[model samples]
Target: MIYLDNNATTRIDDAVLDAMLPFLKEEYGNASSLQHKLGRTAHQAIEKSRSSIANYFGASSKEIYFTSGATESINMVLRGIFERYQSIGKHIITTKSEHKAVLTTLEILTKKGAEITYLPLDNQGNINLSDLENSIRPETILVCLMQANNETGVIHPLAKIAEIISSKDVLLFSDTTQAIGKYAFDYAKSGIDICCFSAHKLHGPKGIGGLYIKRKTRPIQIEPLITGGKQENSLRGGTYNTPSIVGMGKAFELISLKYQEQTAELRNYFENRILQEIEDTAVHASHADRLCNTTNILFKHVKSAELMPKLINIAVSSGSACVSGDRDPSHVLTAMGIAAEDALCSLRFSLSKFITKEELDVAIEDIKSAVQKIRKDSPIWQLYKSGVL
Candidate 1:
């Protein structure tokens, strides 16, 4: 199958696998065990990997906390902060178009009496900066937003968002999962107090990701989500995931060496073909700055649920992988003011560095033919053709 769902997860890079092989095999040891040489070796590897990823985000090694994935990282940081800071103030500002990881976690926080203000998105899948500024209040202790959207790949104006809180004591947290390997984000320079991302989104192994907690002289006090061991400098508590951590470092090395430039070109070529061949198609967030490797499209008279089954060769999705089982229309699209009918008709195609022009050519042909076939059989298409829909 032609894999066009990189936004969900990417195939592990060969180099990443090579780096992790020894850790999984002969180098196996608990990083917390320091009495033996094997344990010391494992500990060293974990620290080196931590330092590498920390440097990428403009953070110190001590501030990077490893977790199972972005989901756990999100929950850990959000819940930890809320638990500690709820006494001072209980307000959180975020957008309605966030992933289930953020949205669902916020729901739990609300139950604990933390007030949440969800900013609405515009037609192009962007939150209004003015609305964001107006939403902030004296009791607001945190602003949680993602760097790039998972469904539409639209980038949030983080620099502008940061500017809004430049003088405020409120912390700024961004879910950097979709944008980490694809773009430039400087946590220190941008004044982002906290952020999280997963390795699987960047061509590394799953089951590994990290949270960046900006260090201060006084130290930030976040209640621990898991309190047992001393892993992650008391931020996260558990045994270090040695192999996956090694793999994550290698994934970043590969991105810096080549994947960024290659993937951008491939995405452009793929999107150009889709627009040229498809009739009555709408590319979500096309007018806004977006991640280079993603495209969310609406095939005007066809439902994506029906079209996806016909285009079996091309792997794609309707929305975030975490919420794919829901039969209802996407919340992200609805937040951006897309009609429920068109949101159901939308499909997200995310290209990666591994894809080729020849593969894209086949995808374009198969996708075009499938849309035509589905639309021909669809009564909705007939109504749209008659200008009655």
Candidate 2:
């Protein structure tokens, strides 16, 4: 299938897999067991991987903490911080368009007596900086915003946001899962206090990801979410998944801007073709600065549920894969002022560095034809054409 669901997950790169093979078989040893040669080798590999990942984001190795994935990292950081600093301030701020990982975790925090302020988005899937600045109070201890949205790929001005909250006592945390490989971020220069990302989104194995807790002069403090063994400096406690960690390290090393630029060109061509060739089509967040490899489109009169099934050769999604099973329309789209009916008609097409121009061309034709077929059978289309609605 021509996969356009890279935002959900990407295929593991061949080199990353090769780097992981030895760790999976012969080099299998707990990273915490350092007395034996096998254990020492595993420990060294884990540290090397950690250093590589940390350097990519302009951070030190000591600042990086590995977790199962972004979801786990999100829960760890959010809950840890809430529990540790609740006495100082129990209030946090985040946007309405965050992934279910953040939203659901925050929901649990609310029951624990933590107050949450959800910032609203405009029609173009952007938050007003003024609203964000005005919302921060002395009681607010943290601001959780994502660098890039998973559905529409709309980018937030994170550096600007960081500057706004730099003087405040509150810390800035971002879910950088979607933006890590595709966009540029420097933990030191960006002024972000904490962030988390998954390796699967960057062509690495699925079970590995990391959290970056900046080591400042005062240092950010948080309690451990898991406590049994001291694996990640007592911040995260568990036996390391050595193979996946190695693969993630290799994935970080392989990230190239050249490949990302090529993918962006292909994505732009796909969106331009779809909008030019299809009737009554609109691109979500087209006016906003968004990730180069993503385009969320709304095919008026054609429901995505019906349209997606018709294009069996293409792998796209109605919204975030985490909540794709839910029957409700996309929360991201609806929060941006799109009606639920229109949200249901929207589809997100995310490309990866591996996708070629030839594949994108084929997918675009298939999408156009499928949309036409769906619209032809749609009663809404007929009514609009006949001016009867």
Candidate 3:
């Protein structure tokens, strides 16, 4: 299959897999059991991986903490912060288009008295800085936002946002899950207090990710979500998934801006072809700065549910893979002022560095054919063609 859903997850890189093989086999020692030579070797490997990941983000090794994935990292950050600092303030600010991990966690926090302010997005899928500035109350403890959107690939201006909240006591937290490998991000310069991302999105092994908690003069503190062991500076517990951690480190080390640019070029070619060859099609968030590898297209009058099944050889998504099973329209699209019906007609195609121009061409032709066939049978398309309601 022609996979265009890299934002959901990427195929593991051969190098990353090779790096992980030793750990999965003979090097199977618990990182925390430091009394034995095997355990010491495992611990050293984990630390080395941590250092590599930290260096990629311009952060200190001490600031990085491993977790199962971005979802778990997000839960640990949101819930841990609320539990520890609810007495200082219970209010948190985030965008309405955040991944379900953040939204659903915030939902539970609400029951425990956390106040959430969901910032609105404009037609271009961007938040007004003024709206963010005005929403910060004295009780607001954190400003939670994602660096780049998973569905539309719309990017939030982190440096500007950091400047806005810099003077305020409120901490800035970002979900950098979709941004890390595809985009250039400097954790040290961004002034964000915390951020999270998963390795699977970057051609690394699944089930491994990291969270960065900034070390400031007056450091931020949060309760541990997983408690029991001394792992991760007591911030997280459990034996490390050594193979996955090593693979994630290799993945981070292998990130190349040149490759990302090439992928972006391919993505643009795909988008341009879809818009030019297919009538009544539009690209979502076209007005905003987006990740280089993503494009969400609106197949006007054609439902994605219908179009998707026809393009069986291509792997694309209507929205975030985490919520693909839900019957509702994409929350990200709807929040950007897209009508529910129009939102349902959109599809997200995210490219990986591994995809070639030849493959993209084939996928594009298949998409064009499938969309045309689906529209031929669509009553909505017929009404539009006749200029009738």
Candidate 4:
């Protein structure tokens, strides 16, 4: 099958799987058990993996904390802050197009008396800096933004936002899940206080991820979300999934320049072919800086539910996996001012590092064929052709 849903989850790299094998078998030991030799070995391996992953984002090993995935990491940051600092302030700022992980957490925070201000996005899927700056108030404790959008793959101007919020007293947090493996991220330079990512987005195991908490000079104060053991320096409590952590290290280490060069070429070629072959098709965030491995297309007269089932050989998504199964239109598209009908017609195609021209060619053909068949009885297409739309 032609897999183009890397944003949802990538196929595990063979090398990463190979590195994880030993830990899943004879080397399996609890990282917290320091008394035994086997347990000590596991603890050392986890620390080594943590350091390796830290180097990629220009962070130290002490600032990284492991989690089940981005969802858990994000929850810990948002809810933890609200629980710990409600007396200081209960205000948080975020973008309208954030993944449900951020949006939903903020929703729960509101119930706990946290005031939220959701900044609006422009047509290009970028948050207006002016709107963001104007939204900040004395009560604002955190500004939660994403490094890049999941549905459109649009990269936000996080550095500029950092600079804007730097002079202020509020902390800046970003959900960097989509940007971690696809683009270069410098945590120190970006001025992000805390950020989250998932390993599965980068060809690592699905059940592992990390959080980068910036400590330029002093550590940021955050309360424990799951209070139990002293794992992750008492910031997070749980037994480490040693094999997944080892595999995550290998995956991050393997993201080289060659993969970026190859995947960018495939993504551009596929997008070019789709626009050329299909009439009335448009790509979201076409004028903005987007991830080279992602392309979100709006099949103007077709419904994604109808189109997807027809293109059985190709795997893509209408939106994030968190909400893809629902009949509701993608929140990301709708936030960019897309009509509900058109939003339902959008499809996100995220490419992996190993995609080739041959796979793309077959995919292009299948996509075109699927759209043609799906639109055969579509009243929207009929009305458009009749000039009554």
Candidate 5:
């Protein structure tokens, strides 16, 4: 199958697999056990991986905390800060376009008496900087936003938002799951207090991800999410997955070396081809800056749920992978003022390092043919033909 669903997950890179093979086989000692030679080998590998990941974000290795994936990282940061700072103030701010990881977590926190203000998104799925500024109050202690939207691919005004939140008592947090490998990030330069990312999104194993908690940003005290083992500086607890961690580092190294640039070119080619060939199609977040590898499209008369299955060779989605199961229209689209009908018809296409120009052309052809067939059978097409919907 042609995989245009990189945002959902990516195939593990061969280099990453090669890096992981030893730990998964011959070097199977627990990283936490330091008494034996095998254990020491595992322990050293974990530290090197940690250091590599930390270096990518310009952070110290000690500040990097690993978790099962981006979802856990999100929960850990929100809970860790909330549990410690709820007494100082009970307010949090976030955008309506965040992935379910942040959106759902915030919902749970809201039920526990935390006041939440969901920042509004513009027509292009970008948070309104003015609306964000107006939403902050004395009670607000944290502001959470995603760097690039999982559905629309709109890159948020993180630096501008950081400017607003930085001067306030609030701490700025960004869910960078879709951004980390797609773009460059420097925790020290972005004014971001906390950022979360997943290795699977970067062609690594699915079980590893990390959170970057900036040093010296003390708006909220952080407590452990899991107690025992003292892993991840006591923020997360468990025996470390040495092989996956090593694989993640290799994936990052690959991205830094070459795939990132090539992927950007492929994405651009795909977007250009789509616009040039498809009629009555609109790209979501067109007015906003976006990650180079993602594109969200709305076919005028077809539903993604109905369209995706028709194009079995090309993988895509209606929204974020975490909430794709829901029948409800995407909250991100709704927040951006898109009509429910249009939102339901939307599809997210994320290209990858593995996708070539030729592959994208083939995928686009498959998408176009599928959309044409679906539209021919759609009632909306009949209404539009009669000049009505």
Candidate 6:
């Protein structure tokens, strides 16, 4: 199958997998134990991964904390801050299109009586800066937003928001899960206080991800989400997953070396083909800046769910894998004010660095034909011919 669902998750790079095997087998030991040879070996590997990830983000090694995925990392930052600084501020701000990891966490906090304001998005899925500014109060302690949207690949104006939040004393937490290896990110330069990412999105193994918190930033002081041992700077406590974390580091090293060139080509090739082909299809959020490999499209009369199955050879997502099984309309699109029927017709196609131009050609041909058939079969198209759609 031609896997275009790279945003949802990606196949671990063979080289990264190779780097992980020894840890999973011969070196399998609790990283917290350092006396024994096996444990020492595992401990060294985990520290190396932490250092590697920190260097990639221009952070000190101590600032990096590993977790199961971006979801957990986001929760760690949000709930941690809320619990620690409850007296500092009871209000938080976020955008409407954040991944459930951020939104649901905020939702739970809201239910617990923390005030929250979800800023609205413009037509191209960008957060309104004025709304963001207006939402901030002396009581607002945190502002959270994702660097890049998973569904549309639209890059949010993080630097602008960071500057705005800087004016206030509020801490800014950005979910960089989609932007980590695809685009350049500098936590210090951006003035963001906390950032989180999943390795699998960057061709690393699943089950390992990281959080970066700036030093001098208020210590994330929430009770541990999982408590057992004092590990991960006492912020996250558990024996590390040596193999997957090592694999994640290897993935970062390899991707960082070729990121600029690969991503430029990625964006260029996809845009060139889509512009030349794909009649009657509208690229969502095309006017906004986006990551290199992600493309979300709305094929007017076609059902994305129905088309996805027919194009089984091409792996893609209607929105997010988190909500893949749900028949309900993608809340993201609906929140952006896309019509319910149109939201059902939208598809998110995230390309991989490994996808060849020939594969894109084949996929585009498949999509074009599929759309033609779908549109022809659609009763809405017949209605639209008489100006009824």
Give the Cα-based TM-score of candidate 6 against the true structure.
0.95
Q: What are the per-residue Cα lDDT tens digits for candidate 5 across 322-366?
A: 788999998888999999998998888888888878877789889
After TM-score superposition, the amount by which residue 364's alpha carbon in candidate 1 deviates from its true location, in angstroms, is: 0.4
Give Cα-based local distance difference scores for all models.
Answer: 0.89, 0.91, 0.92, 0.89, 0.84, 0.84
Off by over 4 Å in 4: 216-218
Please give each candidate's TM-score: 0.98, 0.98, 0.99, 0.98, 0.96, 0.95
Winning model by lDDT: 3
For candidate 6, the per-residue lDDT at 156 reads 83
Q: 387 in model 4: Cα distance from truth in Å?
A: 0.4
Please write out the lDDT profile of model 2 over residues 36-86, one tens digit for every residue. Answer: 999999999999999999989898899999999999999988998899888
Question: For model 1, what is the alpha-carbon lDDT of residue 43?
Answer: 93
TM-score of 1: 0.98
Clashes of each: 0, 0, 0, 0, 0, 0
Q: Cα miss at 138, model 4 (Å)? A: 1.0
Cα deviation at 274, candidate 6, in Å, is 3.8
Ranking by TM-score: 3, 2, 4, 1, 5, 6
List per-candidate RMSD values in Å: 1.2, 0.9, 0.8, 1.1, 1.6, 1.7
lDDT of 5: 0.84
The predicted structure with the larger TM-score, 3 or 5, is 3
| lDDT of residue 123 for candidate 2 | 91
Candidate 2 ranges with C-alpha deviation above 4 Å: none
Between which residue pairs do clashes occur in model 1? none
Cα error, residue 288 of model 4, in Å, equals 0.8
Instruction: Give residue 142's lDDT in candidate 6 (0 to 100).
Output: 89
